[model samples]
Target: MSDTETHARTQAQPRPSDAGATDAGPIQTGTAPEAGRQLPTNDELTVHYPCKYVPVELLAGFGAGCWPCTYEAHSFEEADQLAHPNLCGYGKSLLAYAMQPDVRVLVLTSCCDVMRRVYDVLRDAGAVDFLWLVDLPHLRGPREVARFRGELRRLADAFAAWSGRAFDLDRALASFVPPVPRVDDRVTLLGAHGPLSLVDTCRDELSLPVENGTCTGWRLVQTPPPTLGRAPHEGSCHVCQDGCEAGIPRGDDLDHFLDWYAGALLNQMPCMRMVDSKARAKLVGAPGQHGVIYHTMKFCDYYGFEYLEAAKESKVPMLKIETDGTRQSAGQLRTRLKAFDETLHGMAEAHEVVTRRRGADGGPTYVLGVDSGSTSTDAVIMDGNERIVASVIVATGAKASRGAQNAIGQVLERAGLREGDLTLRVATGYGREAIPDMDSAITEITCHARGAHFLAPDARTVIDIGGQDSKVIHLDEAGGVLNFVMNDKCAAGTGRFLEATARAMELSMEEFCRVGLEWKRDVKISNMCTVFAESEVVSLVADDTPIADIVHGLDMSVASKTAALAKRVKAEPAYLMTGGVAQNVGVVRALEAVLGSSVATHEDSQLCGAIGAALLGLESLN
Candidate 1:
């Protein structure tokens, strides 16, 4: 080994006294331990695979102890011997484990902000030679399989560099199944962890093959594959059914599922609050093909981000479902799992196919995107080849649908096309719901992310200020929304604020931009509320404040408010500015100054939402 490797070994390997010790409190692992139990050797270069609490199937493909799996530590003191009192304990523990010699690689999903920061720490620490972070998008359907395959290929290249072991997909797939000869009669080492546990308490008390590790309360006690296939044991789980259709009793409550995973009672993975980027890279990268990513609460922003990162690293089909931990949702979860299982099974043999509406004589298709805003509605039309055909914008009124229809009609008319000629229509923005005729409605957050991504693939941050609100979104390379922050509580420096101030100053929006650029002195607008700020501006004018200086102060105020949102979302550059406010050169300058980086804005910034909606429609067709 090189000197660098030797140095790492000295700092990373645990002492013999630390045997069977876990970072998450005390673990019982000595005399009563399972037969032949052993920890990965320090010299073996084990990778830490931290899953978001799922079943054993995710760990099936790789050889045992090739990676030492552990649920993340719950607190900082347990994780890092000298962690700060106020620091997020989850990140600390994951990081502490990552520094060990047994952990040469760290794999994790982007489930939350904590994980993202954790990843940053791991990469900056320079302990691991190979670090990869996967940005997992919302896995609602099968198209994600293609995305996963591409990510897996990229990961294989990285693994080859770190481990000097080339990944063979065929061999990997074969290994993904359990060692048992027949899957039909095979038993599974199942565990109920993460969101599943929250949803199903009967994880234990089930007759599964083996139940070990954290988040398993229900145990699979038998695997007599031969005779068991016909008439499996019942009465083990009267609550959640243990995934056996026959075992489900008509009047039984969902609590039987609780008995299915009994091991989780032993320990649980770290909460979203504790995760960070290094932990994510380690946990997400650990899985072989056929990994299951568990995303708990749908509204939980932290875990949501972590799920995204994990999805990015996945090599096989992954199933993501949300649950509120209520028995009422158990049936839905079961159905979702059934669908996921079928999809995973067919992913390999299934030929690539595109679904589209039949065209006249089988001609090409076209997609249209409409972005409805408080101020205006814009439309962008794209052909089947993803090329822009025409764009249109119309002033918005009380009725957003009318404005959208008018914009789309104008775009179609400009292109000399008919409404029936379009194959898909996607609508996006705050007023998206108002346009009920759209084929689909996407969140403005996603639309803006995609639009910015399409415009500049390198852009990782987007700062958008529209007529009524301001937003900051962080995106991965492929234009996936990592997370975002919106000024939904109040309108401070939005276009409306600018317009009101411009009117008070007797200037047009264009003049406001020019006036701010000529300011020689800095002025402060302390109040951010529109009415109060407007009054302050009027007072400043009456007090002989320079028109240039006052405008400069207004621009500064806009930057400060928007910058606060950027900080909240952990903004990184290159940034793209969208929405109506992008037309103001002075505000852009102020934003750049506050952000300490150059900002990119296009002439069609106001049309980004429409363009994004159109793109999504096109993607859906394919």
Candidate 2:
């Protein structure tokens, strides 16, 4: 079969690692050299490249050390000052790293608009001693390959002149090594490029081998086509436009090596930026592939579009994540990735065998559930009859475990029972794992689905707007989660957004909600960012805009974002609202208008996750 056909069929087989495992080691920012590669002495210069497209072998041939420039900045202040604030987190972080004194010479690619702008800004500011921007082609054609080959030659000559070193053909030829194949069942990350930190977290959290198919994650190497029995027609090679009768040219042959190198880089699975990105289908459809974690930058529109397309075409389940490319979102990303893993490989089932409480004979038995969240800790106690014995809610001060202890203690005290009185304890929420005394932990998505179904038996969808995240869950009649989506990395559609808005207006949440519900004007808030929205609100207040109208606009903004999220997952009705933000009448009304349907909420909506956990505990005991 032709290489293209083989590649198409290879989707049914395991894919090889992007770069060989040895070559694609952990990204390094410091002068510490990578393993296997020669370490650079104080007198020697190192060439730092951001993307995989840069020819590291060529750099090594010139007697220069090649280092993958990946580092997490302590702050984006330096980057923001150099580049636009709206630029991608990865770009900003790269800029920040480039400004450091150690980054002497930098090589970058014009892969994306952000990178191009970064190159422009850095070059203009003279951030580094030497900088080169390689012009990458989007397609694997003869002309493009020749063009790239010339660019590579130019790059080599420029580097040689700058460092007073000459390219060693023998060394460059010897550096070429074939990649080994990967065979384990793994998850593939697609969409915008991710940093090493995010990639490592995905691997660790999912506890599965993860193959990075994103732009920044994988590097392509040259693979030759099979030898033909007879001379083929000119330009008949299916993989590349170069029409050589022989297979891929070896690096030892200088003239053919450049053509081979260009073909090799272009023939690999194309990134989302490429016009023809169908090669990604193989990555997503590879054998032993469990799921996909589609990551996109917050301000990047390119990968966002690709994510939607990938999600639609993917055979396996997929999760979409957006980040600003900062460590600030690490905790949130962990929660989502862990929850996705649980969904794919079902969570460990609670033991069927039940242990009775001491003195259970002729006495009431109880179960407990605690939900430790960002804003509040909630606990619920239920009797053997499935009746609520007591419930408590309190602010979740700095520590999750402490807040959990306090909330559970309050409920247990109210029920006139000690901790030992409970048969089982289940924890749920963002801080679920932090609670030490809990017997089991469940994601809020599952708990909310169960609780919503119990509260409103006919409910088909649940919209949960919590302190720091928002979730839309589709449920079956039996309270089982069918599917769900969450927005945890941002505060745009969460209770925190409302709280921040209230603070900016110098009004209590209760007052803000009340005023918002009473507004008659149709004011709109365009900005979804918490900080920017607060400033917009301040400006409106200063302009003598009615408080009610401004509050209404803020409520509408949250509702609009929530509605869009719900639509993404094909939300059905009857709709039930859960989590803290369910208490806001204005938001509920605005959501109804946007969704064109009424949303049901009860007084105990905020405690739904806790209630669900308690119910699960009772189920396990039975």
Candidate 3:
């Protein structure tokens, strides 16, 4: 071993006194553990594998513990420094685990190109005591099984040499167990190997039983081959000329056991990398599944195609989400998962969103809908007759709670009422939870679809461009949300993007609105990134480009991106532009041109979220 390898070993391997490998948490195999079952301990060494295909039982026979290398990184600084910046987020996260000071062993398959590069980087860095890249084969026929068996044997030998331990065939056979079937209703997480934190978040956000059915989460291998192990003289092994002693397979017995083990690992539920992986759809839409939460890692192509296929063929509702495996995306992920939970439960079960307290004297009951957004807080007061009696919009400053209070107070006063007069106050928006005294907090996606239907009865699609995010919602004939897509992680193609450009041009948003319509020449602003687009605006200003034309370009950029999102959800005509951006006539015109259809807007477009919230709240009272 090289000096670097020796150093890595000293830093990583646990001493005899140490407990088993650091707990990577439960693997979330969608089944509860068997009652009173015990797992073997490997205090000396822990072998970590990042994929489901890893043969944990084989490693156990060598007295090495096995754990799923599902580390979600605080940041990608270490991985980014060592590897390309554009590596898939899953690979980056794995690299973070490998580079940890105490990572003794890591095993990864050539599941994707990025992962192969990850192996290369780790090999050069000598980051762990033992790093092995299993040469995964796409096919699982007899030939492939034989090839995989050889690889498994090679791995067993290498690990034995590294740990200075002999493989005990009985221990390996003992580790094998058939997967307990999960038959209960569940929300299945499909697609890529998601971080363990993602599973925890699902449990937190969802009311249903959460199952991590992703490529890494669900690992099922057949129990010891019928021919192989017989407890203490029950039968003699066919391969062992001498009867198997203490159930430890030797010579041909070991080979026979490995052949079965290899087939089990290869022929089990295949991942996207495998040729017959499309058959893995059996994992989804299981009996009593509430829905599927399909996750895709950024820049990883393996799962996205499968996600599309699953979404198309799904019998139950499916929510597709993408993450870059960083803590920064946590808030966005929470919002998406929470909203998805509402869609599955609220829509599927026809659950009532109950609102409390109407007037005892049968006076006009009123519900207040408050949308506490980043830029502005909007409140709408609706009476029992579905009439919007009063509305207010207030600039949300440092605190969303304060802005919500201000909007609620002003709207109540405008309606000649006090807070006591309100029957229900439903909150919607990113800041919904930050507000106080809300009867209930609902997602903006659900609210917007409801509000758009009420505001424009003919509309089948709703386009909402808010300060921090943009969303395109597809609605059914009754204004129920069928599907929605959001660009929440980045400020691009949002109201914030235009605001930054307007500031760069030293113009107020009001001026930006009118000036954009007066453009004489069309300019293409290719960059959609907020910071880069603002720099582009500054450069245009430096070149003395007309402010009207520059503003028009910015509007066109936003419109183009919004149109693309609309296409993803298979949007139809009769579109209603809601949220704060609808007030900007420039964006409306640009959108109309790009969509090749009239994008209708209402005077109360900014209050759509609040209106929707109020409508949903009133439904409970009815």
Candidate 4:
């Protein structure tokens, strides 16, 4: 199995890395301003705008260029340390990126409270030389259009004064380029303004074509009238046209240009802030759209409501993912996208891979599957008849590759088999890419669904709470993945949570599990954050709270979170629990209580992922 890392970088914009800035100079102005604070003094101004309403062509009318500043930060070290803890990750990321020296100027739109707060923080700190917040009206009416026209004219004049250059109206008018609609099957990224990095991830993971259909992607401003010093037939390509009777907008001419510019900005597909949002249907209902990958930011609730509605109404496949807009969720992001891709393509592609590459002869053949997770590595071997012959589990240790080698060696030896004896070897889990001697790799989500069906045919919902992440997978009647949901990027409801609390209580994991079931009273854990949970546990222990009660409380905490995830996927009865956490009887009982149903756990629960991998590989081959 290979390590779960970033599938792709934020597309287009060069997001600054911790190693060093790739944006060296004028050509690439996204570099972070360091302690030396070397601000650019040249006339070639660099501008970053997160909103689509900001007129980059207008900015170019003077001298400045533009960069769309919507990318997840590597970390919020500087932001969390200095900015408000409650601020959303996207706002924090924008604040952090604005601090870079390369971002000398920013033309921010007053889109939301968070954006206004960002402007405040930047203004107070003097983060950039030129910081301006353009006021946007909520409604697109005649009066609002007139108001926005004046706002644009003022902004143009202010920029003209700052850069010591005249506003080239013709140049600004020429910047009005239109977009063409796609006709081929593709995955449309809907909901919330996400960074280019997210779009890049969707493109890399999914089998079909992917495009950002979010608010930013809908920059559908029309070209102005040719009489207003603008060329026609610019089309979708934004190709420049020569031989035009173009001239600067002067007197009444200037007023007319401003009117068109303001109306165009307001008339474009409205964002959540706008009143007429009926046009948003185009985002998901676009032509040739196969599926929708909806992204929402943590604590951002507006788009979440829309996503919920879309999930119920839309006929196409839907995958809803959320993040703090940081690289911390990178691993889980890859896992979800990979599984979503599997869902989009269905079982045909999977069966094709096995048959086309290698299948078993009509004879005795041993197929192997390896699951390398963050905490442990598991391996399972199956014969031609799909009977489990042997299985082994080992600590993942320092390197996932080493742990995989150890697990593979032990399972092969137990089955009395060699490397060449196996007909096919499939790997799954976080470290699937790192494991050596693997013919194919499948996501644990898909593997878990197959494994759960194999273990308990009656199960419709599979709750797999592993070392670092937890997921609720919904399977169809025929053991195919129908839908799924994952928790936030935290260690609240996983094995890691139990492990940490056990360590704090000075009890072994086994003892902790035993004591949890012995509780007489229902102790409540307030917070689900790992660090805070541990602190609450310590306080409870100091208050002379019974150890059994505290242990049960932790179990309940995990159960509550897992139940929420299951509810998102509309999970049904006959639930199956897998992964290492399935060994904990206390958690199993707690989940049963929270879910108001029984949760079945098999002896080989930890090996379910590996078993599923082997079964899938066999099915693919034969």
Candidate 5:
């Protein structure tokens, strides 16, 4: 069998890790580095790079060239303080190890707004000498390349300036290659939009040798566009062309030599905001367009914005995946990839077909999926033919046990079936642990990906906006979760944020959605924090800004924030939008406008997780 056929035939087996194991690790315990690379301890400053006086070995170690400093921690009071409240947990842990008198330069990348502040913390706290701030470009297209390349060059120069050493280009490139293949011979590139742990889990489950270039400080090697920037070739390699063209946007002051000196050489021009008709035209010329495009929820604005147009222009197949930093979508990811590969290889018995139900001998399949969420428990039941039988949503009311029982009872009662009559019961979401009665629990990440795939099997990306949190997942062809990103620390850009804003505005959720749809003029809301956003809205109302416009602005703000988060993890789209936010037409419209693609949301969109969980229960029973 061909490599493609063999992979396609492989069942998308899923192995979920124990709860809490996702966050706890040898890296967290401060043992050996997870990647076999470790920074110096407090008394081991002599072994660090950009050293005041470096021994040669420190300079030669892999991953030793750049030091990453996160902003979650700052030793404002005591350098020796092991822990500090208000500091980010990851940041604090990094700082605790970083301040061990390990004298060295640090490389910082502005992955988020907090990252920008990290530099200030380092500078103000007297923790850094040679600080290289790698400015991040917006998740836009090829315009971002220049900024990224320039930032990388700045970092390189900093390395030379501090240690009088330059990067060996050949050696740097070689470091990216795998040292030796693991025995599994299954190498997986788990593309994600957020942190490394999610990818790590996927690698572990599949026993695949993995390379995490996304998390490491290593930069993407830039490839120049074709001479004269030839028009998009419809027959060219789509991934290579699109990837190459996906550069950072140029700065406003390209002529200003002085502005180029600061890391923000792009002059604050959003990378995706560039006028690149030439690139687009050339991209459209590529032959046999992209095989798949994966987008995260909320963060789909940039990639999602470009995808439909790009797909139209390139005529490529596309997909979407969603996640919340947790690698809970492996099964769905495997499925998506399999389907995509099969379709690409022309081996699929049926060309890509997405339907609510497919099995024969049934009006509908009465399967049940239960999503035990943080704020509520939901249940969705489908017949053998995938027709909806009963769907139930109820307040969890702090008693997940009672809440789940109530939801399941309601759905079962409505379906006129006893609990045992259901063919399957799948459970999902953060509160998976709260329900011991579940036949089996699937992660929300996997469930969301599966649900999105069920709705749009071609979807390579999914964004789920729930009450307390939000996530963007990337999937392969079979709707298996390949990778994911999540919002962990704050409630901004989530359904909870919308709820708070609605309450503060003294508008019902329905009213809030209506107000946004009626907006006549654009008003921008700058803050994403719930409290700050509410304050901004209050001031806008006081200032007599039209309520409709203010509401519109709020929706736009949420879209922008989600888009930003999704970009960090490298989002693409056959975009699927899920969670409660998918039901809010106002926010959905705002997101669709911002992304320039109509998001896929079904009448049962809000019940996707529950549906997925119910499906998983069937798989487990089998």
Candidate 6:
């Protein structure tokens, strides 16, 4: 094909819209309807496909709208009841979407086993009017392309008969839209395809250009070679039996188009399902790529393997997030994304400058750092010399913000200083943003690293178990966060977990911390889930288990979980244990046994995050 011919062919093709579109044309695939585009009427059939293997342009050529199967269910309760509980969330959500009244036709591909099961369930329930399962070839070759082309033809015939619309050769050719080229630096999502909600969150919250390179988002279609003008009276020419009508190709050219289409579909960037997916490295290591946000669905093994492989290949910072395709985990997702953004952009420093009020006798200026945690609020006040002037820790009753304010007020009173006496106020922790009084907010991971280094200057690893989450942070000598790992959305090895177990045993927090110190009997607590662990503890208590042995088991379980997190980040000692849990002697001893090393703890371990926040505030003044 000549350059002129290629250019002309490409210009004739449609430009794909921003939705989940194939290279051939725009396909609306997100949860919400596209702006200014009304929903398809009853007569206007819409075909929804789950994977890229489906021939989307063919449906568009048949006068039916092409849409990708992306749906966000309010809850997975209905899907869990219909499908197996172990089914992938995306597959379950897709099945739930199939039952919706708006879903007219569904085109599923044999991409994954869960999707195939979803097809069976939807078909058995008679969910949609039309359902077709296209057999997607795992390997990309001429033979596979030819086989896929046959399947495309079968789908075309079925869809045409169902919609009462004939496929127009000109329309199909016109529907071929070129892929948009990305020029600017952007973060690429490189693992299993995530829900549209996640994509939107990354774009909106991170405030960075994002490229979807996941299985569902990567659309790779090669531009076809240009052909010479056709002659009239060609075989089965619907446009003019034609040498050509309106300088366009006739229906006789459908075979050639199908051959090209088959090659294009097979030639897309190989998804993780492919036997060899080295091509994925190009997407991850692309020039101008800033970072990678790898998303994986729960119970999906394919993407997890891909993520591990990609993480090894990509040089940029990568964050792995796992979601169940529901909004329940949105908060945790936002936290991880925000911290990743901070790491990329260096936004943890306090941006606002507060005028330092000099002491009446020329004493040093004071700064305050507040850490509003799920269980407690800690405040630290430091002078210009980095010496702690005052500190306070208070129970975070209901509102974290209120607890932070109360702690700050108490610390200021103890320091004999007013709010104006402080040069800057920095906040950290789960409720950092809620503390409006703070000049700036930083993630607890960064703050914890800083605090741990300040307390134990030689410490290279910091393990912090707060009320709701447990995090293991590896740090450099200068207190920079090298890498970190935290427990998932579940409260497993956190302070809350211990509190729950203590409540189940009807033991005070002080008593609970000391009961397990001398325990020698082997009382194993197998369950780590907060709810299940509580139940197990209750059963043990009912069976007349010794309180010391039961407490020891609970402490060991917490230590095992925390130690695993520490090992994941390759934590090195001298290890510093911080956060409220550090005050628990039983947990500290248990952790020491698990790590086979002595752990360091300071008198103000609970105030480390607040102290780190204060140091950041002080640095901003400098």
lDDT by residue (tens digit), candidate 4, 1-622: 0122111111232222211121222332233443555554444456788887887767755545567887778877887766788998788999889877677788899888899999998987878877889999999999998898888888877765555555566656655554443536777787787787887888888888787767555465666777667422222222333332344222443455676778977777778878787767656655567788998888788788888877877877789988787877777788889888887777436422344333344557778999999899999999878899999999999999999999999999999988877888889998998987688889888888888889999889999998988999998887788889876477888999889999999999999989999999999999888888889999999999999999999999999999999987889988999988999999999999999999999998889899989988888866
Q: Provide the TM-score for each candidate, comma-separated.
A: 0.47, 0.81, 0.87, 0.86, 0.51, 0.85
Tens-digit lDDT track of model 2 for 539-615:
99999999999999988999999998887666888999998999999999999999999999988999999988888
Candidate 1 colliding pairs, count: 82
Task: Quantify all predictions' global Cα lDDT against the true fold.
Answer: 0.57, 0.75, 0.79, 0.79, 0.53, 0.75
* TM-score-superior candidate, 2 or 3: 3
Q: What residue runs in model 6 are displaced by over 4 Å at the alpha carbon? A: 1-44, 228-251, 312-314, 347-364, 542-545
Model 6 lDDT per residue over 1-622, tens place:
2322211111121222222222333323322332443444434556777676677766666655666665677888889888898988888889788877767678988888987899899877777777889888888888988998998888876765554455555656556666565645678776775567888888866756887666676555565545512322234434543244554544344465676788777777777777777766666666677888888888898888876776656677778888777788786677777667765665344234454544455656788899988889999999989999999999988998788888988998999988877777888888888988667777777677778888989999999988988888877677777667778588898888999999999999999998888786979999999899999999999999999999999988999999987765667888899988999988998899999999989998899999888887777667
Clash totals in order: 82, 0, 0, 12, 82, 6
- Which candidate number would show the highest lDDT if scored against the true structure? 3
Candidate 4 segments whose C-alpha is farther than 4 A from its true place? 1-43, 80-82, 226-252, 275-278, 348-363
lDDT of 4 at 257: 65
Off by over 4 Å in 1: 1-355, 358-360
lDDT tens per residue, model 3, 1-622: 2221110000122333453442333222222223442222345467778877777877777666667776789989999999999998888988998887667678888877987999999988877767888888889999999999999888877765555565566766766654444546678888887778888899888888787777777776755655577432324443554464554534444565685789988877778888886677666676778888888888888888887777677777777888887767777778777777766656323324554575566677999999988899999999999999999999999999999999988998999998888888889898998998787888888888788989999999999999989999888898877677889879998888988999999899999999999999999998999999999999999999999999999999999999988976778999999988999999999999999999999999999999988988888776
Off by over 4 Å in 2: 1-46, 63-65, 124-130, 162-184, 224-252, 347-365, 383-387, 476-483, 499-521, 530-551, 618-622
Q: Roughly what TM-score does model 6 have, to 2 decimal places? A: 0.85
Can you write out model 5's per-residue Cα lDDT over 1-622, one digit (the tens) per residue?
2222211111111111110111111222212222433433222223222111111111222123322221222333442253334444334434443454443445545644434455566665656444445666544344565556555455544444444333332232322321222222232231223233434443443322333322221122122123212333333333454355444332222112112222222332122333442332322223322333343323224334555464444444444445432234544454444434433343222122222332334433567778887777899887655666888999888777788888989999988987766665666776665775555555676677667877788888788888878888777888765555677547899888998888878899889888788989999898899999889888888899988898888889888877765664456777788888888888888877777777777877888888766655444433
Error of 5 at 86 (Å): 11
Which scores higher on lDDT, 5 or 6? 6
Model 5: lDDT to the true structure: 0.53
Q: Which sequence of candidate numbers ranks them by TM-score, best first? A: 3, 4, 6, 2, 5, 1
- The numbered model that scores best in TM-score is 3
Q: For model 3, what is the C-alpha lDDT against the true structure?
A: 0.79
- Model 6, residue 220: displacement in angstroms? 1.6
- TM-score, model 1 to reference: 0.47
**Segments in model 5 whose C-alpha atoms lie over 4 Å from true places:** 1-94, 98-366, 399-402, 456-461, 473-485, 563-576, 616-622
Model 5: ten consecutive residues of lowest lDDT: 6-15
